[model samples]
Target: MREGWEYKKLGEVCCPKNKIQRAARCFDSSDKILYIDISSIDNTMQKVTDITSVTFGDAPSRAQQKIEYGDIVVSTVRPNLKNIAIIDRYEPNIVASSGFCVLRNTECIERNYLFHYVTSDIFTQHLMKITTGANYPAVRDQDVRDSIIPLPPKSTQLAIVSELDNIKE
Candidate 1:
């Protein structure tokens, strides 16, 4: 909706990368990294609970995205903005499902910016238009990778994130 912001698909700005859970192994109950599944992620921002575990043997081939503090992890299946979350210090090493679309941030776009942008009415409307499914209403990984967004100045993006943070506080 703002100037300089161009319409793009989720894939162009993001890689939609994924890691496969290994086979011929079982993860025990006490594993360290939190295993995130569709059920583990709520459609709305909520306390992350119901986490499972992935053993060293079962750990994903490689972490699809290094989910650092402030990064946003979006669920690809239902493809709802409310399900997005800003990674925090409290969030330890974790791996999400293949059904999850991990957005790698860029110099032109900050993580917080992507979070808000994806959740915005403008982007959501576009997302709704692109997504297809009668029951699942899914958006493909390729579609996500090609998605475009308004390219704002870095300082402006930081300021916006700050304002949003204040509101949350």
Candidate 2:
């Protein structure tokens, strides 16, 4: 660990998850959204490779998580597959499947830094430990919230994210 770095639970550095309607409460036929599902993420590339356009009338039951730009979405199901990505360019109609645990950064932490932390092998292994079900191993959203994150100062975080993003490119 760095001399000035600290550790915080992910939930501590992230905004509280807003409570949204869990089910198909109501939707007009004309209402539509760009939905990112587990399949939408190319885990190998750590990017959203496919976004399905769906109208509210035919929206998947799991398309309930509204994400904003800079938010991180980690797949709760099949944590080993590492389906995670940051919402780099969100629009009003962007929503992700509830299978993803959406993470919105608090002021203290940089969003890109948080994204990099979760993409680590350590993070995936931690989730694997809490994963349940033999046929469908998965972690709950709460499990993801409880994970630990290493926090450097904002400047250090930016440097780390920048280096990693350059490598990614």
Steric overlap count per candidate: 15, 0
Clashing pairs in 2: none
Shift of residue 81 alpha carbon in model 2, Å:
0.6
Output the lDDT of residue 35, model 1.
Answer: 60
| Alpha-carbon deviation at 169 in model 1, angstroms | 4.2
Runs with alpha carbons beyond 4 Å of true place in candidate 2:
19-29
CA lDDT of each prediction against the hidden true structure: 0.62, 0.86
Give the top-scoring candidate (lDDT).
Answer: 2
Highest TM-score: which candidate?
Answer: 2
Model 2 vs. true fold: TM: 0.90
lDDT value for model 1: 0.62
Question: What value of lDDT does candidate 2 attain over all alpha carbons?
Answer: 0.86
